[model samples]
Target: MASAIPLTRADMKRLADYAKREGVKAEVQIDDFIFRVSADHPPAKVDGSEESELDRELMEFDRKHGYR
Candidate 1:
């Protein structure tokens, strides 16, 4: 049985910030009803064009990772 753990607002906010800063890519189960956070995965080449700025940023990220 899975029991939900109550999280405080501060805990949730901190978790969100950590996810953003680390660019967390995925979560996978480690045990029954439990999961572990995975490292940031390699980004896929973006499709379509909308924001020039975002495109530029993605390019930069890829360049830094030698994915370009």
Candidate 2:
């Protein structure tokens, strides 16, 4: 399991400053290259196609069973 690290006030300030100066996002997220305080890329997108397909299949099954 990966451990979590708390960001200090200075770190938050730097990130906020960078975001404001660069016109990036206001969202503060720790990515793979965490603690950059000035990372140029946005956070990676999470893929949920498999989960969505499973949900659709489950919905279809429920409809077939008159449970929907």
TM-score per candidate, chains pooled? 0.32, 0.33
Q: Mind giving the per-residue lDDT tens digits that candidate 1 earns over 1-68?
A: 65765555676566666766788843434345433344565778765675777989999999999997
lDDT of each: 0.64, 0.73
Model 1 root-mean-square deviation? 12.8
How many clashes does each candidate structure show, in the order listed? 0, 0
Evaluate residue 18 in candidate 1 and report its C-alpha lDDT on the 0 to 100 scale: 72
Q: Provide the RMSD of all predictions against the true structure, rounded to 1 decimal.
A: 12.8, 12.0
Q: List, residue by residue over 1-68, the lDDT tens digit for candidate 2.
A: 77666677787788778886886765555665355444467677866998899999999999999998
